[model samples]
Target chain A: MDMVRNFHMAQGLGETSYAQNSPLQKEVIESVMDITLRSAMEACAAETVSIADLGCSSGRNTLSVVENVIRAVCERRREATQQLPEFMVFLNDLPSNDFNTLFSLVPEFVQKLKAEHDDGGGILVSVAGAPGNFYGRLFPSSSLHFITSFTSLHWLSQVPAGLLNNEESVNKGNIYMSPASPPLVATLYFERFQKDFNMFLRSRSQELVVGGKMVFSFIGRRSHDSHEKINECLLLEALEKSLSILVSQKLVTEEKLDSFNLPFYAPSTQELEDQVYREGSFTIDSMKQAHDWTIHEYAPKMLSNFSRAIIESFICHHFGEEIIEPLFETYTQLLCEKLVAREDIGWSKIIVVLCKSAAS
Target chain B: MDMVRNFHMAQGLGETSYAQNSPLQKEVIESVMDITLRSAMEACAAETVSIADLGCSSGRNTLSVVENVIRAVCERRREATQQLPEFMVFLNDLPSNDFNTLFSLVPEFVQKLKAEHDDGGGILVSVAGAPGNFYGRLFPSSSLHFITSFTSLHWLSQVPAGLLNNEESVNKGNIYMSPASPPLVATLYFERFQKDFNMFLRSRSQELVVGGKMVFSFIGRRSHDSHEKINECLLLEALEKSLSILVSQKLVTEEKLDSFNLPFYAPSTQELEDQVYREGSFTIDSMKQAHDWTIHEYAPKMLSNFSRAIIESFICHHFGEEIIEPLFETYTQLLCEKLVAREDIGWSKIIVVLCKSAAS
Candidate 1:
């Protein structure tokens, strides 16, 4: 999980592109609209404001997030009888993300912005792509004024180091931090999250000015225990079952499946808050949890496509590309059948807004 | 024509990966041994030597080129009784390249470097990937020392602007600057190359320090005319013929076929020399031509895979992925059949070594 090298959203603008399959992320973006706007408004003092959307994978939502920030800052300026500032927007992602589709929409976006502010207000929008992982520094010091990331922090920098072939068989059949795993496996995942999340905060704090604000939303659970009843792990459980089926049929090796682990951790709100406090760079302004996704009629298929877009490169790297079509077919069928009986299975997302402390 | 955004070498280490299909490029790298060694020996005076390889598509060859540069620099230091300087190597390519496969081999590359040196030789090697096109600025001012690009400068920054759907109905069936193409179509391709090559030289001039050297090799023609007996353009001709057959079968649309154009231009030796003089930054140290390849055994499908690895993402963007398998099959069949009667067909490569002028 050298995230920059190993990960990519699916390529191009076809039926399987991340742009076409990312409605869940779009919905979550809309869910945090108020928080994103308020933070942008608070940081509208500069004549040139910079906004970054970390892990802004390929799609219309990439620009949609930037649009929300622009509108928020513009409205605040109008309310205060001030002129709009020129915007510098950076769309950040891993090196493997499909930047072509993201750039294809720029012409129309620029035209729409010009038409909306047609009074010769002279506001300029300059967009550039910064391709790298957000767990490290991507911008110059004190350069980013406002930053946002959606549904992306769950991906750690790498898989936890200690989980490979332990004597006690930790995370043997499981691919992620699931309810069926023992408590020690869960602790290893949490420790990795703490390390990664701390580095992310440290890097962003160095890049942001003293008064800059960051708003992020990612998957988490309401309960702090590993055996909690959350759908995040259950969805992984279903996919793991599909992979195990492939292994049993001699289509995939059991050893290959055992070595593969998803670099993900769904933390609780208290865990995130604790890390934020210990990291000592930013203060939380607000935190909200929404238990929105469940195994409903559309959720299973939608989740399959979403998972396929994000994780297919990693899986195809381990399992050859020849197996991809059959593998996904079997996984989708199993996911649809499993959702019929698991009404209590769903995941919660936690959104937090924070401000960089001047005295830290 | 957005090279960084659209073009990519294939992904993974599997059968279709560029890693498995690039033996021809590896052979070409070995053929340029003397020039690479001479350039490294001349620049052994600095404590930090910077080297860049443009169009460094994924494979064993990418690292093999860097290994050659490092070894040359080290051997130069050993001969002169001087200490080894810290080396910074930059491998550049299109943004969509399979960098995961490239980065995965880093640990072993480093291990091999250390084992050979063995004395506490203070020879630190740092490798970083700069993902973008070489036709524009990719590095800071006066930052590069030695640069090498192989088999890639023939790609224009874009398809020449004037050749699309013109009223003359010229180049109607042809896909490239070939014997079948009208003279005007050939002129347009040359003009585009002239502009792009001029820009490339101008940008590199600003990046390299005075007396710094650049070595680049690309596919070219001995004659200035496109109608000459060169196999490079003929190879494309056969593929275009295969695509046309598919169009006749209604498998691929005529409109789609008509819209496609390869962003390539094969220049003559004098053409490159003229541009180098006009750009006024570097002086040609040496230029050599080798007519190396023709359609023989292992050349047909080998060319197809080489083309596919470079152009598949672009083709899959326009035509659906379903056409890929059948398309290559028909293409391989046509190429094999055409190669039977043509014995004089071959591609000539022109390698030029240049040094930056001391005066602006």
Candidate 2:
């Protein structure tokens, strides 16, 4: 409950807001846009096509995917059959998302739809927000034709249980599962990921009609080794260095750092494939893995703000707002030096397109 | 766009908040609880049952329906099938609702669920808030097993077009779709209701699986006469008289009154049945209509605050907060005297349960 109250992409159209700092997410979403279009065209057979974008945090990017889907489907149908289905677009996030900002953007989005279609119901478009956790059932049985998520499936519903108070915290000296962490700690993280990922697929499977398609992209490890293969390793290492500086100065408590575990995971391609096969609801049609983080394109300031937007709520609740400016400053400088030293910052994003089976 | 920001139910759990003033809605929901349970049992076939409460304004009432659904389903399944399906409940409302307050109460709600089931894995209840307009699709196609909406569908997406103009609003003296209004004003309100309600049913039809059920209860009319049959007739009349007093006192503007038309409509039983049949998605199983408002059971103070909670956003936006206390004061006294005159306040409520067909 407190997380919902405190966790949100910053509101408003200001520079620091999620609306401004979301190009990274947009990049990941755009990477899968073609697969999303092709898969939907293959699976979509309804008169009124329904599509849901899960974990749809507030931003212009929220509508970017919706527009892509709508435009692609409409143009393809026009070329082939001279018919268009009315569109139902559902944008979902946690309840505390900046919906006011999102809704303020809707009128213009609707106007664009009108410009594409005709005024006399060439196609009717209806959009709404669904605020909930995606780890569980957020829709009805066999209800959706397509579901798309970007850079959000990595967020576990909660921090993995048993990581805390494990004799002194299994993930001690760091906030997330890292290479420095012990074998037992790595196992715990993988177990939690398996549990959560299975739950996500099972819930979405029930909500999706047979042959419905889901396209997802998230930060992931290139190999099963948690510390060695993670895409955001350099970034996490920089965050750890900043925290160590604070702790060494006695400005921040070591205990606080020990207890705080990032409820995040980067599954390997092998791990993802194994989960898909075991879950037995969806079959992977294609998968793409790319180490695509660019130091020049996404400078340190941009990347710092991006990380801050996602984790600020929990950090603020723990370390107080006073630590935010200085902490991010240190993080920014550390990440910059590291990025300059090596072009490979070691962040690989994985994108996959999967289809719900006809029988499951 | 302005409507989403200015159309929120009153916030918080204070005396004047919607949370405190929502018992009237609760009264309506309680009247249909048994029907929701039985119809859902008959229609539900999946191993995991899904249910949604649409227009679930914040407070104790949001969970009231969910709890009822969970308890009844669990008990019935235990009795007949010797097995209970895992449960998924989606509580839906507009974005501006007090979801923080609602989520704060979830821990206790989950605790109660735990206390009710003891078989270790008897029932796993997952509850989530879907913040969106129910007049559009909030879920996937054929996903839901049951849907319940109470006292919310009457709100048109926009104030019926043509009720206002650059010059002035057509229904100058009234704040809602009253019979005394001009013929064109009534037609516009009916037209808007027809469009919005048809969109609502069509969207939900695609989201619900075959044999899924929907139960709805909202303020309506016992007769087609707009000046009569409504439960809020006396209260609206009193509100009109109070606004007239303000206009005469030069404390309010005739233009403001002219521009204001409540986004509310209480359709007659005939109108509802017509919409249901015209939409052609579902068959009405049973419907109950009653002019059941009791002056003694509900004091004037209680009733007036209820109206204030719902309409405060528009009132504050147009007339400012300064008028709230005095206006409701004038409204309470007038309604009290009128209710005393005949013991009949002339408000009717209609409740209905409908079933999706085997084929769309």
Residues forming the 10-long window of minimal summed lDDT in candidate 1 chain A: A121-130
> Residue B89 in model 1: shift from native, Å?
7.4
In candidate 2, what are the lDDT values of residues A50-161, reduced to their tens digit?
A: 7889888888887988888888888788788657887767777776777656766665676687687883555666676666667776665776899999888777777778
Write model 1 residue lDDT over B240-308, tens digit each, in one string.
888899999899978777777788898999899999989898888999888876336466788788767
TM-score of chain A of 2: 0.95
Model 2 score (lDDT): 0.78
Point to the candidate with the largest TM-score.
Answer: 2
Q: What would the per-residue lDDT of candidate 1 be over residues A237-275, giving only the tens digit for each residue?
A: 778888999889889887878777888898899999999
DockQ of each: 0.06, 0.15
Q: Model 2 over residues B190-276: C-alpha lDDT tens digits? A: 888899989989988977888999988887877776555344566676788788878887778888777877787778888889998
